[model samples]
Target: MTPDAGSALAGLTGADSVAHWTQRYGHALMDTFGAPQRVLVRGEGPYVWDADGTRYLDLLGGIAVNSLGHAHPTLTAAISAQLGTLGHISNFFASPTQIALAERLLDLAGAPEGSRVFLTNSGTEANEAAFKMARRNTGLDESGNGVRRTRVLALEGGFHGRSMGALALTSKAAYREPFEPLPGGVEFLPFGDADALRAAFADGGGATVAAVVLEPIQGEAGVRPLPPGYLALARELTAAHGALLVLDEVQTGMGRTGTWLAHQHPHLGGGIVPDVVTLAKGLGGGFPVGAVVAYGERAATLLGRGQHGTTFGGNPVASAAALATIGVIDRDGLLAHVTDLGAWWRQQVAALGHPLVAEVRGEGLLIAVELTAPVAADVAARALAAGFVVNPCTPTTLRMAPPYVLTREQAATFTDFLAALPHDLGEATP
Candidate 1:
């Protein structure tokens, strides 16, 4: 390394360390994310330390990415061992780890025979692959002469991803306005409105529909799950109309919702099977990996050879990291732990009777505390100052997705903070 770089690195622990790195971050990085929250140096389990050596409970889990928590021994060792053995062989070749992970995901999803998996490097890319799959399944005629379907339906408040195709499937106006003329034929339905969904599919509209993409739980829109029977209706309509049902489990999959996939939950998913399920976030625990699971022969063959591809996707190390994460979750029984702990924790927070808190909602550890006012940003700031990480996902919601390994004692600390929250905390809401 350069002498200047070495000197700057050595000063990371000095006084004014956060200020120094934050200033450097502004100059060296793009401002897409506004500003750095903290210069985190290291993490263990559910805790992380800033460059200044002040520790904080990581309740956000890297926006629901760090499933096994940071620097988990098993995840680390798996990545290291795989890298030592063989890291990247490109998509031109296959590895045992990649195959094993695909099999595991299919098994977890209860996929039918002839199902397949296409791996990617991020959630957005996984959705992109799913998008193409939807487009390809455009209801072919018996004679296979004319393309029949051309539209894809998504829900309002749904967040698929930011890339062009995935962004087209996302609903927020602010996210879509700037990128007008996106891949066309994506329509947004009112979230959880069975009437609107039915109307869209009525009057032969379903014939022109290619797919219905949805999130089991809308994470960015304040951790809202689809209203009961909504998913089942979608599945039924899609099946009747010959349209693909794609579930974007990027934020809700891989045990984040106390289940392998949120759609597997009886209450949330209504026991309906979707044709396509896209996954990422915690799939690799902390490593970068994503996947598109196409169920059945028809969906699996939508993307034939050369229809979709990636370079560093499904690399041995990433596959091993995902395998290790799945192993830990299964062996440790973190799914049941998350289900029980999340239910108990939400109840405890709600019982605190904090005036700012209007409601506590979500499944498993993926939670959102809705405020009576739009003071989520201010409350999140307070949480940071108090050595806890959280996300102001919306004006009135504080989202938390702590690691699965978090103990009740550690969770109680946050509840204690909530119980003692000041009444005037929202006075300076911005």
Candidate 2:
């Protein structure tokens, strides 16, 4: 065999297949996500198999992206049918599924009559579209001459995305400093701090701000939900100041929190709609699709004919996958299933009486177990060793976002493992 062909075959089959591939990965790929924990081979429902055929319950759900879990028949079938019929088309043209998905998103959003949709491939792209819309809503054309309003505001510890514009709205200094001089005029205030929000609007010089973006539930900040009336307060403040309110529902939307959108939850100020909403993550079940939905004429018309475009935004197969996902969620009653599972799981985890676990907080299947000690990384590692997959969002927060179709028995088994974490790690049992 040729040298390159021989090298490829060296890692294809072996008892140490994962090790060989991991070594190859470190050499071939960028060191962006650090070392991968395991080399996953395949998945079904909420379980995944490793290179060695070891199975794990995937509690993280691909960082909240896999709403219908792995290998969901409906999602897979929809994608296959659409790809077989019509794979993709350019933005210059539109497909039946594309228009249908847009209509379905508007219906799910419960948007007003003139609401509009802009589709993209991921959450960052969705946020970029929203940011551009916010800029345009200031009545300032692309020319630098007419600058009506330029400032954008976000919340502390809130994450929008990693792209330059979205990263500017993200509050993490480590994430922002590396990409210095980001799209400027973006400020962050303490999340859920009503006083801080009110004061910022008060000092905005009566319409110096273009938009205020926020996540109703902060996922990267350890599943932190907004305090009572906080979203309503934001709506009131932004409306009073004539600034747009952009809700980044990238992580919390798509029934992850047992609602079409977290902001629609009664506890989170139901019936209060924002000017713009960004959605991705679970929208396509495992297929990649993101969208920006604008409510009124003012917000919808911000981007004119040639302002923005996407090559693979509303591909027929991806749109079909999303439609199938939404249909399954509604047909299988996953909304109520996730609601009951979330409450029950939280109660069981908290009642485990483990000394390390301090509190459990979240909505629906999106949850975080705050540790009394900063042993979250340790716990996650231990859980993986015990055949479960979880995420350590922070040093003290263990985040869990399992599939909507996860059964009660699967949840019970995971909870039982969590209760035995300390003992499994060779520490004294609680």
* Candidate RMSDs in order: 1.7, 3.2
TM-scores of all candidate predictions against the true structure: 0.97, 0.94
lDDT of 1 by residue, 329-417 (tens): 99999999999999999999999888888999999999999998898888888899999999999999999999999999999999998
TM-score of 1: 0.97
- Worst ten in a row by lDDT for model 2: 421-430
lDDT of each: 0.92, 0.88
Candidate 2 per-residue lDDT over residues 1-430, each given as its tens digit: 3247554434334654678668767987999998889877778999988776688999999988889999999899999999999998898889999999999999999999999999899999999999998888673556855538877889999999999999989999999998899998888888889998888877545377889899988999999999999999889888887789999999999999899999998877576989999999899998999999999887899899999998999899889988999999999999999899999999999999887788999999999999887778888988999899999999889999888989889988988987776533424323
Candidate 2's error at 69, in angstroms? 0.9
Q: List the residue pairs that clash in candidate 1.
A: none
Maximum-lDDT candidate: 1
Candidate 2 Cα deviation (angstroms), residue 323: 0.6
Best by TM-score: 1
TM-score of 2: 0.94
